[model samples]
Target: MRDANREWVFAQRPDGEPDMDSFELRESDVPEPEYGQLLVRVRYLSVDPYMRGRMRDAESYAEPWSVGDVMAGAVVGEVVESRSDDYDAGDVVTGNGTWGDYSVLDADSVAPVDPSIADLPAYLGVLGMPGRTAYFGLLEVGEPKPGDTVVVSGAAGAVGSVVGQIAKLNGCRVVGFAGTDEKVEWLTDDLGFDAAVNYKQVDDYGAALDDAAPGGVDVYFDNVGGPITDAVFPRLNVDARVAVCGQIAHYNDEGVPTGPRKLPQLIASRAKVKGLLVGDYVTRFEEASEQLGEWVATGELGHRETVVEGLDNAPDAFLGLFSGDNIGKQVVRVSDPADD
Candidate 1:
């Protein structure tokens, strides 16, 4: 075991887009496990759009990260030492852990991870929070029906990718909007989307959406919530359901940017727009995990991951999300669980 631990600490809050100055990579002494706690070496960590929101000094569902504090997120790690019966050495686990080389967490806070089930990094992506978010938000909020025209924004992203697949599994015609031609092709040619729109190349978003979704959108799973969402409003069918999962397009905005008023369209269509958080479905995590695992095991659900090596590169991986640099979930590999 190493005597020194490295971590990313919240340094300065960003006014617009986050950069290297936003966080400081510092080294400290490794902490030991106390009573009912276990020491784990972080193998992989997730960098998500939601983390951007937490950086701001604002009131939201998640508490804001104070400057000078250690950055935190979902992590998969291997326990090297334990002080509780619930966890033992050599056990792999997943939980809300810090962005660091090592973390001492309460045994109850982490659930055991089985490497035989899936790839280790998958726990930070498909089999973790993003997967659960897509599962509950799309099925429960969007309530897609058979033959429904389901439109998804950020279609190539972690959560959006899963949403599109689940909708397809339910027999819905799926349409997706992404920023690049490559992502659009992956959504349509690979993921079985009925149609894919390249938002960056389009002149008129509403026209593009209309062309892709000729039958009209019955269920819309929105991840990027700027022009794409505005355009979707006019194309929504009556009694449409919109799952407002994430507003990645606006996460970096210094202030709320004005957009087209589309509430009237919602009223006219009698549509329902609901925001969701994965934590809200904690009670049903097992149910969703079980089904998603089955789909992955049977090859019904497919996924991709963009991995950034090294703990020091975590910030780079996180900033890449806004640029659409990742085709799917962005994960930082801190170390190999089998290594020290």
Candidate 2:
């Protein structure tokens, strides 16, 4: 049994942009669990744009972090020992572990993770929350009809990449927007997105969108909302559906950005734009997971992972996401051969 624990805490809220100083790496005595809790050794940690919103001292769909509190995130782990009958030692598990090498969680917080179909990290990426977010956001909200033309912003990232693939699986013609040409290449050449635009090089995203989807945009899966998103709003077809999954551009922004106005365009096109969160769709996860698992095992839904080699690199890995440093799901390899 370990006598100590190491975890990252929120050091301070950022004024405009988050810096490395916002995080504090700390160590303390290992926390003993209550009767129903289990101690898990983290294997992989997830870094997502939503975590940026939680850092601010403001009202949000989730709570803001108190200074010195453990930052909120998710991890895939192994139950080293269990105090509850619902779990036992050596059970591979997945849950919200945040930025820590180990965590004590209640029985309800952990889920059984199958490594035979997917390695432990896949539970954090392809078959986990990001996967669920993509599946529901695209299928339910975007409603991509077989011949629909879909455009996904932040297309090279975890959720965006997955959304593009799922849209393709549904027989939609998918185009993606990424920050870098390398990411653009990865999306088109590797992930099967029909077209990929490097937003950094494109002065007019709307023009690029038009060039890519000459027929008109039937579905817009927006991961980044800002000038780029504003450009897309007017391009939607009459019955176009927009799934607002994230706004990474706003996440790190110093202030809320004013736009070129959308209601007018919304009225003109009768397009629909709705914000989406994966937690709201629970009944469908099991069904989606079954299908996703099948595709993953069958090599139909291929995935690429950008694994940062160590736990300490977690923050760097997270920050890199906004810069398009990762082409697929960004995960930290906290430990390999986790159960020694």
* C-alpha lDDT of all candidate models, in order: 0.91, 0.85
Best by TM-score: 1
Q: Give each model a TM-score.
A: 0.97, 0.96
Q: Return the clash pairs for model 1, or none.
A: none
Q: List the residue pairs that clash in candidate 2.
A: none
Alpha-carbon RMSD, candidate 1: 1.2
Worst ten in a row by lDDT for model 1: 111-120
lDDT of 2 by residue, 247-296 (tens): 88888777677778888889878899999999999867888788888989
Mark the regions of model 2 whose C-alpha exceeds 4 Å error after superposition. Answer: 1-3, 338-340
Q: Write one digit per residue (lDDT tens) for candidate 1, span 288-330.
A: 9899888877788888889999998999999999999998789
The C-alpha RMSD in Å for every predicted model, in order, reads 1.2, 1.6
Please count the clashing residue pairs in each candidate, in the order shown: 0, 0
